[model samples]
Target: MPYVAVSALSHNGLIRSHNEDSLVIGPWTLCSTETESPQTLLFPLGTPLVVAVADGLGGHPSGDVASALVVRRLARIGPLLDSEEAVRDALTACNEAMYASADDDPDLIMMGTTVAGVVMLPRAVLTFNVGDSRVFDATRDGLRQTSVDDSPPPAPGHRTTSLVTQTIGGTVEFTAVHPHVTSAPLAPESRYLVCSDGLTDPVTDDEIGEVLRVHDDGKAAFELWKAAMDAGGPDNITLALVRVSE
Candidate 1:
């Protein structure tokens, strides 16, 4: 039988004071960790498997708290995310919980996070995201972004924009999110990359593709993280590589 494997890592990056990012793969979660080395896990094919990253919104209070909250929720509900609607409903619950947390605390107002990842089903994979975090179809041929970015066009000479159009929870008033979710057949040797903007902001898709072409699995993950650090690692870095193997 085929199986799904995920190699994940998280770091605060060079500029960030601390890691506000969080990760979830099935029932496991990592919040505010400094894991430059990749940690890999394997899961059987039949059950639902979720691998995701939640990047806490920068320049917001309790960004860490917000990200941690969402990823933990994802971990708890991972096995049930077999369809797009299930993923959407889960995100809605997370958004509501974010707002409810803020309402109960004065300092956590406006806390928010961007999420992106893939859900591995028996025969297909679902890619989903909100805000600027990303999901990518990584193959030897090239790297293709599967998740839609919620940010507008950047200014001249700017590689990226910090401003995002939507997120899980960014305001005192509750805001709904239109998450980007797409499905594709899950063939053997299939691979996907899920990450916060920390990896994409400084590194170009072409550069990332080059790395994927040359390396694989944990090595690919490490090389990508190195590329971001070489580019001056501006924000909290978190990423995961998912592959379906026989």
Candidate 2:
């Protein structure tokens, strides 16, 4: 059976006073202040595994709490997800949970987060995202973005465009979440990058592909962080690199 080697990490970045990003690998969850050493785990061909990154809305209050809540909710549903519908349901549940939490508390009003994740199965991988966080598929041909950003299209010649059109708990009202979900056949020796905007905002797609090609899974993740920091890590950085092999 094929297995997956994963290297996941989260950093507070250079400017943030607090880390508002969260990550999930299978059942384990890590917040901005926490870190996970690189590790590899073998899963049977048909086993279901989940890997995700959540970025709290930096402009909103309690953004970290919202991000943490999103991942924690997903962790519970991760094991149960087996199909595209299941993935949508899981994300919807997360959205509801965030809204409910915020409704019950005055301080948590307007808390929101962007979520990007993948559910890897034996024969296929399902990718999903809400907001501007993204997932990318890296292969011999090139790097392709798999998840679509839920933000307005940038105007021509407009360089500064970083506004998300939708997100979990983005508004105080109860709004249905529309997560971008897609699936593709699983292939051996394939690599996938799931990350928050912190990394994408600083590093380019070419840079990401170069790092993945030159370094192993573990080092690739670290180099990505370095690339973002070297470019002035202005936001929280979080990412997971998953490689599939027989």
TM-score for each of the candidates: 0.98, 0.94
Q: Candidate 2's C-alpha lDDT?
A: 0.85
Q: What overall lDDT goes with each candidate model? A: 0.92, 0.85
TM match of model 1 to true structure:
0.98
Worst 10 residues of 2 by lDDT: 36-45
- Off-target runs (Cα >4 Å) in candidate 2 are 34-45, 158-160
Write candidate 2's Cα lDDT for 1-246 as tens digits: 678777888888788888899988777788667453444545554567888999999889899899999888877777788889999988988999898998899899899999998999888899999999999997777789999989887779764368899899878778899888988998878789999988988888889989987888888888898898898998998989887888
Per-residue accuracy of model 1 over 1-246 as CA lDDT, tens digit each: 898889989999999999999999988999999997999998988879999999999888988999999999999889999999999999989999999999999799999999999999998999999899999999766789999999999999998898899999988788988888888988778999999999999999999899888988899899999999999999888989999889
Give candidate 1's whole-model lDDT: 0.92
Q: Enumerate clash totals for all models, in the order shown.
A: 0, 1
